[model samples]
Target: MIEIYTDGASSGNPGPGGYGVVLKAGKHYKELSGGFRKTTNNRMELLAVIKGLEALKTPSHVTIWSDSKYVVDAVEKKWVFGWVKKEFKGKKNKDLWIEFLKLYKIHQIKFVWIKGHNNHPENERCDQLAVAASKDKANIGIDHFYESEQAKETLF
Candidate 1:
């Protein structure tokens, strides 16, 4: 089984954001992280899981560890399925959710929620990666969908 630990951070609700993911299987391990010029913590949280799953080269049983209830409960509690049936109307991060579901269907996945900043070793490492990525201006990427949506919101 593959185990993935993930975390996300943002300087502001819609400010600089990043996600960190640590993937472990048997003796193999990998870390993944990236920063966005403007995004939300919740987006980063979900994206961390997405990135972890995406990195897998084949289908397998996977356990995802996350510190965000927004990411965990939505899957564990089946809220995302309901949102899907409704075509994701009134939902935030539709782009990411759709992408996640596509990858999710290709593998067996489980989610475990943990308290943030609680001193868990893997979680702490993920948090550190996420925070550092968010602060890395040189390598920051753009969340085009998010930025465009925000631009539209400001026009109304």
Candidate 2:
């Protein structure tokens, strides 16, 4: 089974943000992280899962651990499907959730929620990666959706 641990951090609620992922399968391990100039913690949280699943080259049994209840509860309780049925109206991370579902259907996946900042080795490592990425000026990337949405909000 592939075991994945993920974490997300934002310097401010809608400021610089990043996601970190630790993926392990058998003897193989990989780490992933990226930062966005303008985004939210929830977007980073969901994007971490999306990125982890996208990195898998083949379908496999996978288990994901995350600290974000927003992510964990939505999937664990199957609220995402209902949201999709409604065309994701009034949802915040529709883009990431849509991306997540696309990759999600190709593999057998399970999610477990863990407490953050509690010294779980992988989780702590992910948090470090996320925080550092968020602070890395040269590597920061644009969150197009977030920026565009903010622009729209400002115009209206």
Candidate 3:
């Protein structure tokens, strides 16, 4: 069984943000993280899970631990599927969601929610990684969809 721990952070609601993931399969462990210049915390949260799953080279039984209720609850509660059935219209993070669904179908995934900042070692480490990445301006990349959406909103 593969266990993945994830966390996401944002300096501002719509500011620099990043996601952190820790994947462990037996004794092997891996950490992944990236930042975006402009994005919401929720996007980062969802992206963390997506990245973890994407990193897997083959289908496997996977359990995802996330501090984001938005990500965990959405899947555990089946809200994401409802949105998908509606074609994701009027939904935020449609791009990421679409990508998530693609990889998601390739593996058996389980979502678990862990309370944030509760002294959980792995979760704390993930939070630290996410915060550090969010503050690293040099390595951060543009969140294209978010930037384009902002541009479109400003034009009207």
Candidate 4:
């Protein structure tokens, strides 16, 4: 079984954002994260999980650990699929959630909730990655969800 730990951070709710993912399978371990010029923490949180699952080279059962109730609860509570069904009305992180469901169909996934800033090593590493990724020189791209909304406002 593979184990994954994830975390997310945003300089402001709608400011620079990033995610962290720590994956361990047997003796293999890896960390992943990246920042956006503007984004919400929720997007980065869910994106971390999607990225980690995509990183897997083979099909395997994965146990994901995350401190975000938004991410963990959405899956555990089965609200993710429902959001997709409703076109993600009033829901955040729709793009990443869609990507997550795709990979989820291919792998056995389980979610575990961990308290943030605890003594867990994997969780701690995830936090560090999130912070570093947010400060990355390459912004990659600004989150479109917010940018689109902003565009709409300016058009008025």
Best by TM-score: 1
Query: What residue pairs clash in candidate 2, if any at all?
Result: none
Error of 3 at 33 (Å): 0.7
lDDT of 3 by residue, 1-156 (tens): 999999999999999999999999999999999999989999999999999999999999999999999989888899999999999988899999999989889999998899999999989989998998898989998999989998998999
* TM-score rank order: 1, 2, 3, 4
Pull out the clashing pairs in model 4: none
lDDT string for model 2 (1-156, tens) is 999999999988999999999999899999999999889999999999998999999998999999999999999999999999999999887888989999889999999999999999999989998999999999999999889888998998
Candidate 3 has its poorest 10 consecutive residues by lDDT at: 71-80
**C-alpha lDDT of all candidate models, in order:** 0.96, 0.94, 0.93, 0.87
Best by lDDT: 1
Q: What TM-score goes with each of the models?
A: 0.99, 0.98, 0.97, 0.91
* Model 2 ranges off by over 4 Å: none
Stretches of candidate 3 exceeding 4 Å from the true structure = none
Q: Write the per-residue lDDT of candidate 4 for residues 1-156, one digit (tens) a residue.
A: 999899988889878888899999899888888888788888788888888999998888999999999999999999887998899999866667778988999999999999989989989999899888888866555777778876787999
Off by over 4 Å in 4: 138-140, 153-156
TM-score of candidate 3 on Cα atoms, chains taken together: 0.97
Q: Which consecutive 10 residues in model 4 have the weakest lDDT in total?
A: 137-146
lDDT of 2 at 88: 94
Per-residue lDDT of candidate 1, residues 1-156 (tens digit): 999999999999989999999999999999999999899999999999999999999999999999999989999999999999999999999999999999999999999999999999999999999999999999999999999999999999
Q: What would you estimate as the lDDT of candidate 4?
A: 0.87
